[model samples]
Target: MPEYKQFPLADTAEGLTEAEILGWRIKPGDEVTVNQIVVEIETAKAAVELPIPWAGVVTELLVEPGQTVEVGAPILTVDVDPGGAAAPAPVTNGSAPADPQAAEEEMKPLVGYGSKTVVAKRRPRKTATATPEPVSEPVPEPEPMASVHTVSAPRGGYVPLAKPPVRKLAKELGVDLYDLTGTAEGGVITREDVRRAAEPASAAPAAPVAAGARERRVPVKGVRKATAQAMVASAFTAPHVTEFLTVDVTPMMELRQRLKTSPAFAGVKLTPLAFAAKAVCLAARRTPDVNAVWDDSGATAEIVYKDYVHLGIAAATPRGLVVPKIRDADAMSLVDLARALEDLTSTARDGKTTPEAMLGGTFTITNVGVFGVDTGTPIINPGESAILAVGAIRDMPWVVDGELAVRKVMQLSLSFDHRVIDGQQGSQFLADVGALLADPAVAITF
Candidate 1:
């Protein structure tokens, strides 16, 4: 018989204890190559694609998609035959195959590799044309209209059905497969279809939720569980002092608009978040002291002037607040930064951010503007000495060229560990970010 091997989930990153299975790429009996993306998983930090480590034929899937599994758990089973196909079908109680068609159907690839039935449908037949009626003028033929069909199971039925997780996603977005256009192979519904349905139309109000909804209880695990423990410990152990700075951000907004039309930023989303991030990075360069670490055990201050920018973007997810760091933000162009931000935000919103994505953030930027709030004194994420909060941009009266004029303005709040950064140093960092926003041309100087 063919020897079966189990591939357990590996540690995606440090501090990640668990992950939710998003979906599988291959089915049972399909040959999978090394480094082929066979599975997609969501960790606390972000949704990441996982590649198969060894080349082999898939034998079994151990974990169902959408199931929350701990790190090191068995995820799938594979038949590793380095030489060639060696094993024969096992004789169950020495019984022989009675129905060949049933066996052939069983051998077909299912989503979980024999876990469920593939959806199938029937086909239509040709029809004869009616005899032409005796008339003086010939009847005009009707023009063929384009037919838009919803995605569904194949004519033979859906093979390799999506796991429970994908179904759950479909339900949350209020998507009826009967109404959506599927993009999966052979018209099978995919998770992407559900996501597309969730997007709200611009200028249209969002659908209202059911009144008096019951609270959902999700057991804390993975990156979310780790962040919670660290936050509780930090909040009580460290002294946090948050300061605010309201500035006119009209110039930064104007710069973002112009960049979107530029050849370099073509096809990239140039938003206020990009400007806020750039301001934070530039401000960090000016005041290195704000990026220091407070070592309580050593009873000394460690001011770190990081050579590279590991800027963390704070995301509020359904799981919890997770801060995933974008490594080497300083090396990224404005367009690249915007793309990264979009990807990171998408991963976070989907509850797939992994643990490795959460670690090693030198500084963090949280946008409270998405919530429509003016400003907030945000809590500092653990291990990081400082965090900057970007508030909603609003039009208000302000002094422009010594005259009171209406202009776009926003409030920025900075929170720091008092033990490491003094008030003067904190103020300087905040001032620098504000200055950069007031005149984005200063970014070129840096």
Candidate 2:
């Protein structure tokens, strides 16, 4: 007898409900060891790799790539006792092994990993051999296109097994569900199957669709979906008040140049974002309201203020917008803050940021300046009181010592939760930040 156990999907992060399978590193019959990287999953925050807990020969992959599996659902079946499996056939307790799906599973072969062409297909059983099937009836939809998972239990329907979303996709693509086969888990049809079935007809001659109707339909299940939900929640829940400030940052620019050449700052890549981040931290000290949150989940609603800052830097990555925080950012020196910013940006760019690093942020800075856009009303991140948007710095005419002069100028936009932050506090915090950037020597007053 083969000792088999199904591996259930575990929560990769705090309160994670589901994840989309990105890829599988192993196939059926492949020998795997404990703690071996098996599959990569994309959660609400970032993409994460999952490892198996037990080592054994792969008996079956229950879920195909691109399927969104809920936490605790079994995804893979492993044969832990493969070497001790040369025994007699199983004894059924009054249950016959002649069931169509059960018999089909026994005869199924191991498919080459990621091979879309090889899959299990079970025909609709007929009552008699002489009866002819109808010609108008279309074949059932096939499994997922990524790999051969399993043939679902024998079922009779208008077409092969397909989920509701898959059926809707087929209708949108003008594909008949009866024309294709499923390669997904339990022979369930997936969005990929519909897209693949529609490709031939699209290349032939697509119907007069509104431009790009059949272009692409990316499933919103990961970071993109999370961001959308957060944005909508923040926009509707938080009463946002935005204020703008334009500053002549000639002194700050000069300081950066000198610091770059200085021995203490050598080999460090300091950017304008680093300056804005530092300024936010400094300004937060004088006006703690910007670093506060309205906690309503407790027994009594309260406005909670923190002494230290968990500064979040909003970064746009290939995956989506991720805001990873720098813990205790206000306690660090200018050099340390600059280095942390560099590392955070690097990690976010590589899409390796952990979900834990993105939590518990007290404030955020969004540097829209990198895109050369001049200031827009930014939305405050959920759970945080305020957000700062820094715009592009350019040489602009300014009055210095009663004379017109071209100086490095930049714009700052602050959006704060009005419930926790009064207009005076928001204006004061924005002013303090602008003051620090306009004159680097103002730290002595703070």
Candidate 3:
């Protein structure tokens, strides 16, 4: 007899209640060590790898890929006995036993480890068996005539063939998938077909779809779902006030070019964002309200002012939008800030950002300029007072010493919680940031 231990989902940061199973690193009958990663789970914030607490042989995986599991639910069962033999490989439904070598090769180790290659083998087709002949019977004739306008239901017990996402869309729209004719390959139902079926019969006729018309339905889960909820809450709860400023950033651009070739900034990818982040941190000292939070949870409403700057940079990743904080950003030099930003962006892009990195943000900056957009009113992150949006920098006509000349200019939009920051304070803060970028030398005055 073997002792079995169940592994439940651990409580994560931000009180995430559930996570989707992205992939499994270990399968049944594989031996795992203590603290070895067993699966990758995507939460509303990031993709996290779960490690087994007790070393054992994996007996069963209770959850499948793409399944959303609640916290404290048993995801896997493992045999904990040290001398217990590995569990026998389970047969797949409607398939032959997998090759032992192939199974062994497919089980890759956790992150940062090299994976072994497994050759793909096609399943052998099943052979037909001989059957006896059936006896013939007389068929009955129709008795009465029905209304001409009456539509009959689809014949046979066949159901529509559709992917999970398409099925979800049909369910949400309350459409009968079986009634809609599939337009995709192999007569499979698609998202567009469901949408067409969902339109009201009394409404105007929809325009004809062009050839090759297609649609893709992506599930709003994991980071994307969390981001949506946060944005909605912030937008509704915070009385936001947006202020815009156009700054001549020629001096900052010149500084960036000079820093790139300097020995002090070797091997670092510097960008305009680094300068913007520095300016925000420096100017935040004068406008402390911008870095403060409004707390009404206690007996009385209070304005909490933060002395340190935990700057957050909003990053758009394949998973979704995430804001990872650079702790103690006010204390770091320009070079240090650049290096920190590089690491933060790389980690976010790889979807390996930890939940802890996303907490304790005092102020945030979203660089929409990277996408070639001019500017956007970014929502303030929850628990923070303000957010800044940076726009594209282009050569524009500006008064340089009373003479019109083309200079590098960028647009900056700041959205602040009106409860914490007044219009005057917000305007002054925005102006200070603009002045810093317009002339890098102005930062010394602070």
Q: Give the best candidate by TM-score.
A: 2
Rank ordering of all candidates by TM-score, starting from the highest: 2, 3, 1
Predicted structure 2: lDDT: 0.79
TM-score of 2: 0.75
Question: Which regions in candidate 3 have their CA more than 4 angstroms from the true location?
Answer: 82-215
RMSD of each: 14.8, 9.7, 12.3
User: Candidate 3's error at 166, in angstroms?
Assistant: 16
Clashes of each: 17, 14, 1
**What is the C-alpha lDDT profile of model 3 across 118-211, one tens digit per residue?**
2222222233349844649754333211111112223463546666457656767767777877899878888899998987677678778777
Q: List per-prediction Cα lDDT, in the order shown.
A: 0.70, 0.79, 0.80
Q: Arrange candidates, best lDDT first.
A: 3, 2, 1
lDDT of 1 by residue, 97-118 (tens): 2344533333333222123222
Better of 2 and 3 by TM-score: 2
lDDT of 2 by residue, 1-446 (tens): 55455566666676777888766788788899988988878889988877886778886677766679876666776666786854423324422234445434333322211111212222222233476677688865553222333223333533366654465567567776667778888677889998988775544764567877657676677999999999999999999999999999999999999899999998888887888888889999899999999989989999999999999999999889999999999998899999999999999999899888999999999999999998999898899999999999999999999999999999999999999999999999999999999997998799
Per lDDT, the best of the predicted structures is: 3
Q: What is the TM-score of each candidate against the true structure?
A: 0.64, 0.75, 0.73
Tell me how far the alpha carbon of residue 430 in candidate 2 is from the true structure, in angstroms, after superposition: 0.4
